[model samples]
Target chain A: MREAALSLFSRHGYAAVSMRQIAKEVGVQAGALYNYTPDKQTLLFELMRSHMDDLLSARAATGDSGQDAMARLEAFTRFHIHFHSQRPDEVFIAYMELRNLTPENFEVIEGLRRQYENGLEDILSAGQSDGVFAVSDTKIAAMAVIAMLTGVNTWFQEGGRLSLEEVEQIYWDMVRKSVAANP
Target chain B: MREAALSLFSRHGYAAVSMRQIAKEVGVQAGALYNYTPDKQTLLFELMRSHMDDLLSARAATGDSGQDAMARLEAFTRFHIHFHSQRPDEVFIAYMELRNLTPENFEVIEGLRRQYENGLEDILSAGQSDGVFAVSDTKIAAMAVIAMLTGVNTWFQEGGRLSLEEVEQIYWDMVRKSVAANP
Candidate 1:
C-alpha cells in the first residue's frame, strides 16, 4: 500500500494524489487504506520516516567510524550515491514532497535529516581536528557535499557513458579535495 | 498572471493547480487567461523559460568571463547563489515542476539549463587548461558545483547565522578547493 502511494506521489505530486487513487493502485478499497494509515498526511510522514530510518541504520551498518576521517568520508560518499540511486522514488518524495508534510511532521523529518547530515559533519570535524581537512564550517561543508553527491541522481543512468564505479571515483576524488587541508 | 501561476505551482504541485484557480488568483475570468496562454502547460513552460532566460541574462551581465578562470569561477559561484537566493519560488518551480512539463517542453527547458551549465563548464575547462583547476571531468564538475551552490536555497534564510555574502564566500571556498589541482 505504501509502495503504491509512493509511486503515485512521486509521479503526481502529493497534492495531486489521493487516498482513493493509492488504494485503487493497491487494488484495495479506499477504506482499507484507513485501516493501515489514519490519513494521507500520516502515510506521507511514515514513508519519509521509514526512509530516514533506513538511511541511518544503513549508515550505522557501514561500521567505518573508527577509520580515519578520509576513509570514513569516502565510504559515506559511495554509500550515499549508491543508496539514493536505487531508491529514486523515495528520494524524489523525500525532497519534493517535503512541503506537503504537516509542520510537526516536517520537524520530525528535518530532525532525522539533520541527524543524517551530522554523520558527515562529525567526520569533517574529526578530520579538521586531525589537521587533514581545511573546512571552514563543518555543517556547511556537510550540506554542500551531500547536495553534490545526491545531484548524481539527476543525470546518472545505469548504462550511460560512465559506469557507476567510474562516477563514484570521480565524485569521491572531488569530495576528498573539497575538504582537504590547504597545501 | 504568470506570477500567480508560479506562486500556486510552487506552493501546490503543478498538477494540482487548476487554470480557474490561477485566474482567480490573478483577478480574471478563467476564459481571460486563455487570451494570454493557450493552456496551463504553456503557462508553466513560459514561467520556466522566463526563469531560465532571466538566469542566463543575469549570468551574462556578470561579465567576468574575460577574467582568469579562478576569478571567473568565483564570480559564477557567487552569482549562482545570489541569483537563486532571490528567486526561491522560481527555483522551486524549476526543479519541482520539471516532471510536469510536456516532453517537448522538458527538452527545451533542459537545453536552456544545459546552456547555463555549459557556462560553468566552460569556466572549469578554461581553469583546467590554465592549470589552476584539476577537475577530472568538467561536465560532471559543473553539475556538482551548481548542485552544491543551489542547495543553499534548501536551508539558507536571511538574517540567519551567515549573511548572503558570507554564505557565498563559504561555498566559494569549498567549490574552489573541490576543483583545485592536487598539490
Candidate 2:
C-alpha cells in the first residue's frame, strides 16, 4: 500500500492523488485502505517520515564517525549522491510535497531533515576546527553541499555521458575544493 | 488570471488545481478562463515559458560578456540568487510543475532553460581556457554551480541570520573557490 501510494504520489503530485486512486493501485477497496491510513494527509506524512527515517538510519550505518572529518565529508558526498539517485521518486516528493504537508507534519519532517544535515555540519565544524576546511559557515556549507549533490538527480541518467562513479568523483572534486583550506 | 493561476498552482500542484478554482481566485466565471487560456495545460506551459523567458532576458541584461571569466562568474552567481530570490512562486513552479508539462511543452521550456545554463557553461569554459579555474568538466561544473546558487532559495529568509547580500557573498566565495585554480 505504501509502495502504491508513493508511486502514485511521485507520478502525480500529492494533492492530485486520491485515496481511491491509491487503493485501486494497490488492488484494494477504498474503505479497506482507510484501515491502513486514516487519511491522505497521514499517508503523505508517513511516506515523508519513512523516507527521512530511512535516510537517517542509512547515514548512521555508514560509520562515518570513526573517520576523520575529511573522510567523513567525502563519504557523505558520495553516499548522498548514491542514496538519493537511487530513490528519485522519494527525493522528488520530499522536496516538492513539503508545502502539502500539514504544518505539524512539516515541522516533524524538517526536524528529521535537520538531524541529517547536522551530521554533515558536524563534519564541517570538525574540519573547520582542525584547520582542514575553510568554510565560512558550517550550516550553510552543509546545505550548499547537499544541494549540489542532490542536483545529480535532476539530469543524471545511468548511461549518460558519465557514470555515477565518475559524476561522484567530479562533484567530490568540486566539493573537496570548495571547502579545502588550501586547494 | 495568470497571477491567479500561478498562485493556485504554487499552493496546490498543477494537477490538483482546477480552472474553476483559478477563475474563482480571479473573481471570474470558469468559462471566462478559457478566453485567456484554452486549458490548464496551456496555462501551466505559459507560466513556465514566461518564467524561463524572464530569467534568460534578465540574465542577458546583466551583460557579463564584457567582463573577464572570473568577474562574469561572480556576476552570474549574484545575479541568479537575486533574481530567483525575488520570484519564489515562479521558481517553485518552474521546478515542481515540470512533471505536469506535456512532452512538447517540456521540451520547449527545457530548451530555454538550457540556453540559460549554456551561458554559465560558456563562462566556465572561458575560465578553464584562461587557466583561472581548474574545473574538470565545464558542463557538470556549470550545473553544480547553478544548483549551489539556486539553493539559496531553500533556506534564505528576509530576517534570517544573514542578509541576502551576505549570503550571496558567502556563496560567491564557495563558488569561486570551488572552481578556482588556486584557493
Candidate 3:
C-alpha cells in the first residue's frame, strides 16, 4: 500500500497527491491510511526514511572487507546503482519529493542522506590518504559521484540496452578512473 | 512579478502555489498576473524555457576561439556552475517544478534539455576522436557530467567555503581526469 502511494507520489508531485487518492490506489478507506501514517507528510517521510535506511544498511552489510579504497568505492557505486535501479520509484520519490517533507521529518531524512554521503566522502578521504585515489576535493567529488549515480534512476529502464549490471560496471569504471591515484 | 512567482514556486512548489499567492508576493491583483501568464502551467513553462535558452545562448556566446575540446568542456563547465549559482531559484524551479508543465510545453523544455545534453555529448565525441578523451560510453558520460555540473545548484552558496571559480576548477579537473586518454 505504501508502495502504491510512493509511485503515485513520485509520478504526481507530493503536494498534488491526496490521502484519498492513495487510499483509492490501495483499495482502502482514506481513514485506514491514518492507521499507518498520521498524514500525507508522515507517509512521505516514512517512505523516504525507510528507503534511505535500507540503502545504508545494505551497504553496511556489504562490509569493507579486505578491499582497497578504490575497490570499496567501486563496490559502493555498483550497490548504489543496482539498488536504485531495483527501486526507481522509491528513489525518485525520496529525491524529488523531499521538499514536501515537514521540518522534523525533513531533518531526519536529510541526516540519513548526509550519513550516506559521508560514507563516500570517507572512502574518498581514505583513498586519498592511501594514495590510491586522487581528487581535487573529496567533498565535491563525493557529491559528484552521488549525483551521477542517482541520475541513473532518472533515465534507466528495465531491460534497456544496457543491463543493470552492465551499467553498474561502466559507472564503477568511470568513477574509479575519475579518482584514480595517478589521474 | 515573475521573479516573485519563481521564488514561491521554487520554495513552496508549483502545485502548492496559486495565482493569488503569486500576485500577493508581487503586490499586484491576481487578475493582473493573467496579463503575463494565462495560468500557472504557462508561467512555469515560460520560466524554465527562458532559463534553458539563456543557458544555451550563454555557452554559445562564450566564443569557440579555436579552443580544444577539453578547453571547451572546461569553459562550459565553469559557465554552467556560475550561471546556476547566480540563478539558483530558476535552476530549482527548472528542475523540481518540471512536472507542472503541460505536455506541449514539457516537450519544448525537454527538447532544449536534450539539445544541451547532446552538445556535451558532441564535445565528448570530438574529444574521443582527437584522442584526448577515453570514455567507454559517450552518452552515459555526458549525462554524468551534466548531472554533476547541475548538482552545483543544489548545494552551492555565494559565500560558501569554495568560491565559484574554485568549485569550477575542481569539477573541471575531475571531469578531465575522469575522461582523459592517459589518466
Candidate 4:
C-alpha cells in the first residue's frame, strides 16, 4: 500500500497525488487509509522519514570499522548505490518530494540527512588527517561525492549492460581518484 | 507573471499549481491566462523548453573553440554553473516537471538533453583519443559529470557561504581530476 503511494507520489509530485488516488491504488476505500495515515501530509512525512531511517540504519550496520578512509568511502558508495537501486521509488520520493514535508518534518529529515552527510565528511576529515586524502574543502568534497552517488537513482535502470556492482566499482574508482592524496 | 508561476511550481509542483492560482499571482482573471497558454500542460512545457533552449544557446555562444579538451570542459562547467544559479527556478522546473510534458514535447526536450550530454561525451572522447583523459566508461562518466553540474540547482543560493565562481572552481577541480588522463 505504501509502495503504491510512493510510486504515485514519485511519478506525480506529492501535491498532485491524493488520498483517494492512493486508496484507489491500494484497492481500498479512501476512508480506510485514515486508519494508517491521518492525512496526505502525514503520509508524505512518514514515507520520507522511514526512507531516511532505513538509509541511516543500513549505513550504520555496514560497519566502517577497520577500513581505511578510502575503503570505507568505497563501501559507503557501493551501499548507497545498491540500496537506492533496490528502492528507486522510495529514494525518488525522498529526494524530489522533500519540499512537501512540513517544517517540523522537514527539519527532522534534514537533520538525518546532515548526519548521513557528516558520516562521509568524517571519513574525509580522517583521511586528510592521516595523509590519505588531499581535498581543498572537505565540506564541498563530501557534498560532491554524495551528489555523484545519489545521482545513480536518477539514471540507473535495472538489467542494463552494467550491473549495480559494476556501476558501484566505476563510481568508486572515479571518487577515489578524484580526492586521492597522490592524484 | 512567469516568475510567480515558476516559484509556485518549484514549491508546490507543476501539477498542483492551478491556472486560477497562477492568474491570481499575475493579478489577472483566470480566463486571461488562456490568452497566453492553451492549457496548464503547455505552460509547463514552454517553461521547461525555453529554459533548455536558453542553456544550449548560451553554451554555444561561450566560444569554447580552439581550447584544449580540459579547457573546454572547464569553460562548459563554469557556464553551466553560472546559468543554473541565475535561473534556479527554471532549472528546477525543467528537471522536476518534465513528466508533465506531452510525449511530443517531452521528446523535444529529451533530444536537447541528449545533445548536452553528448557534448560532454564528445569532450571526453576527444581527450581520450588525444591521450589527455582516462575514463572507464565514457557514457557513465558523461552522465555523472552532467549530474554533478545540474546538482547546483538543488542547493545553491545567491548569498550562501560560497560564491558562484568559487563553487564552480571547486566543482571544476573535482570534475577535471575525475576524468584527467593522469593522476
Give the candidate number with the greatest TM-score.
2
lDDT of each: 0.93, 0.93, 0.84, 0.86
In terms of lDDT, the poorest run of 10 residues in model 2 chain A is A61-70
lDDT of 3 at A32: 91
| lDDT by residue (tens digit), candidate 1, B33-112 | 99999999999999999999999999998899569998999999999999999999999889888999999999999999
Model 3 over residues A68-108: C-alpha lDDT tens digits? Answer: 89788988898888888888778767767777787888889
Candidate 4 lDDT for residue B102: 86
lDDT of each residue in B139-181, candidate 4, tens digit only: 8998888787778777778898988889998899889888887
Displacement of residue A173 (Cα, Å) in model 3 is: 2.2
Given candidate 3, what's the lDDT at residue B83? Answer: 78
TM-score-superior candidate, 3 or 4: 4
Tens digits of per-residue lDDT, candidate 2, B51-141, equal: 9999998998989877899999999999999999999999999998899899999999999999989999999999899999999899999
**Shift in Å, residue B37, candidate 1:** 1.1
Q: Top model by DockQ, which number?
A: 2
lDDT tens digits by residue: candidate 2, A23-98 = 9999988999988889999999999999999999999899887778889989999999999999999999999999
TM-score, candidate number 4: 0.95
Q: Which residue pairs of candidate 2 clash?
A: none
Q: What is the DockQ of each candidate?
A: 0.76, 0.88, 0.64, 0.70
- Sort the predicted structures by TM-score, highest score first: 2, 1, 4, 3
- RMSD, every candidate, angstroms: 1.0, 0.8, 1.9, 1.6
